[model samples]
Target: MTKRQRFLQRTRSRLFSKGAPDYILLALVVILVLFGLVMVYDASVIVASETYGDQFRFLKLQTVWVLVGAAAFAFTYLFDYHNYPKLIVPAIVTTIVLLVLVVFAGPLVFGSRRWFSIGVVNIQPSELAKLTFTVYLACWLAKQKQRSGNLKEAFTQHLKTELLPFAFILFTICFLIIVEPDLGTTAVVAFTALAVYFISGTDALHTLGSFFIIAVMGVLGVLAAIISPYRASRVSTFLETIKSGYAPDPWISGYQINQVLIAIGSGGLFGIGFGESRQKFFYLVGNSAFTDTIFAVYAEEFGFVGDVVLVLAFLMFVSRGLRIARNAHDRLGSLLATGITVWIGLQAFLNIAANIALGPLTGIPLPFFSYGGSSMVVVLAGVGILLNVSKSSEKAVFR
Candidate 1:
């Protein structure tokens, strides 16, 4: 039979197979995207008005991206996710080209050359890099596993073949991002790659050895940052404030964090009311309210109750994502789900914690809620993949 006939046969078998529908996860994704839209509008109004001379500018752009992202989500849902393996090489090549292009062709933003400006909007290649790398690695590793039967075959050659290439890719990407000076994103991608490596079951010893190398690389990364006067100053400022009781100057390194604190603290038990944020009035400034410190803007406008509801929504997403991973039909599917869950969940935790002063200001946005096209698009696409996996699950896909 031709490939098209085989595809039709498989599709019919899958459609008539004994498995639950995947609407539940799809619905949850829609809910999160909608929630993000509401929060983005609330957080970005002032920034947009001040920066772009229109209150609805950021909101309009975000709406467009969300719409495009949702369409991508639906496209993936209708397509077979197992076919991801077929697209891996092209995706990786595309990602690498973008990454390289960003270095030479992209415009600088916030002292980092991370975005590729296309007329009206800016696209961050690093965001797409995460999903692309995850899918490629998972696909490659799974095939390696299938070829390895006994422990000895797996140990002697399979692990080396599978892991070394991943390590090289991770290091190269990490180096480029660090050069871009997007420390937070580089860290996230590096760690996510490590998670995939660990899940691939590439020998405990190899995994542990990789951990050691990564730790050394991390230390060197810190040294590199220290060598840069500006970065060194930030680190010093971060440490100095810890040692001295003197309040941090709002004009310096502490400015962003202070604004974040004021926004959250001013809200108290009840928020300042919708669109009544005092901080947004030449206080928070620029895209701060929309991206890195969105939770602060949210807290200021929605109060404690709103915060709780948002957290609950995230908790629900996490639970459902984990469920999808657990019931995945195969190891590749399981690893893909788990990696995405960790990426979104950990990033969310980091963003929330940074806003509340639980950690240093990492300049990373809350996933789904932040005002960025690449993140919204790629994250939704990931959710689409998760839904595809859910569709293939033995349990009810709709439930």
Candidate 2:
């Protein structure tokens, strides 16, 4: 067999050593990636043509990223997932430092400095930080799971073992991102951390208390924004648009959300039949066709049916991820698998929700489907790690 075939066979053997992976998850990922490619091309064509004078500009860049991401995924699959826990601290530290560096040394764009230029490609440290935080949290939690007796003991144990370390790391990261002022990414990381805490079997009362505190913090944040002239203006514009019949001006604050809703409405049931989306043709200015608003393009073209299918796909991915967690060979493996799964599912849900106006506009990308270099690469790499975990889970040494 060729090296590639050998690698696949060996990994499959290990993963199925416990039992075969649910094919549904793999199928869903494949389907989403393919659909994303089509929609990305469709949504970004006009923008690409306008900016680069080439209709295929965005498509070509996305294709390159996908190809590179696939290689990353493959490399992760060939390694052992359990080994990652050993490297968690250093990885987290590196990410944390990068987060700090981005604050001082990163380039500022769109009123945020979340990106660090690494040669030709600008890298978002926060994206990698999300995964690093999850891995570190999982390892820390799994270690703590051993010392607890009852719920109270577990709660206290978690507080000392998990929360303290997590707090320092999370605060450092969040502080940097807030300085960059990428509220959306900070929110995503916070949500991902909450998901990990929830799945790690923390006490409900404690978790609820934490949630309440977070909610209060968020409200306070908005209140602080209300006092700042610019942030207050942005908030006021969003509220005004919602309250009034239509936003009178599109050039300012409400433009992106307004245009997204319009694109969704224009698509109807079957979508404007692909590549015919009018909003993408300069109707929407700030929202990138392939990234934050990719779902809008999909909805406009695919309509309700298409939307339903995307939801179903997410459900399948979550189901398989949960299943993998259940069958994980050891505590570390289980935690890693669960953390990764929750991260992906949570992001997917949040992105789709934002697109449909179920929530406020958050600039999060749809996993695998949104046009972004770091997000796509990170997600695929995550999948590879999960696959590796599945491979050795059956024989995992659970201490």
- The estimated TM-scores of all candidates read 0.87, 0.85
What does candidate 2's lDDT look like per residue over 66-140, in tens digits? 888889888877777667768888998898888888878888676567677776477888888778888888887
Ten-residue stretch with the least lDDT total in model 2: 390-399
Highest-scoring model, TM-score: 1
Write model 1 residue lDDT over 1-399, tens digit each, in one string.
999999999876655554644555567667777877887888777767767899888889999999988888887767887788998899988988888889788887766788988888888888888888888877876676454566677665744786567777777777766666666677677777777667767556567647765885687468548544555555555565556632267687777777888899898888989878887666775777887888898899889988888887778778887787777888778778777777777778778876776666657778888888888999888887877777767555434
Which pairs clash in model 2?
Answer: 14-391, 15-391, 267-300, 271-300, 271-301
Off by over 4 Å in 2: 1-22, 118-120, 148-158, 202-209, 212-249, 393-399
At residue 224, give the lDDT of candidate 1.
Answer: 43
> Could you tell me how far off, in angstroms, the CA of residue 142 lies in candidate 2 after the best superposition?
1.3
Best candidate according to lDDT: 1
Q: What is the C-alpha RMSD of each candidate to the true structure, in Å?
A: 6.0, 4.6
Deviating ranges (above 4 Å) for candidate 1 = 1-18, 146-155, 206-210, 216-220, 223-247, 397-399
Clashing pairs in 1: 20-395, 20-396, 20-397, 21-397, 21-398, 22-397
Indicate the residue-level lDDT of 153 in model 1.
77
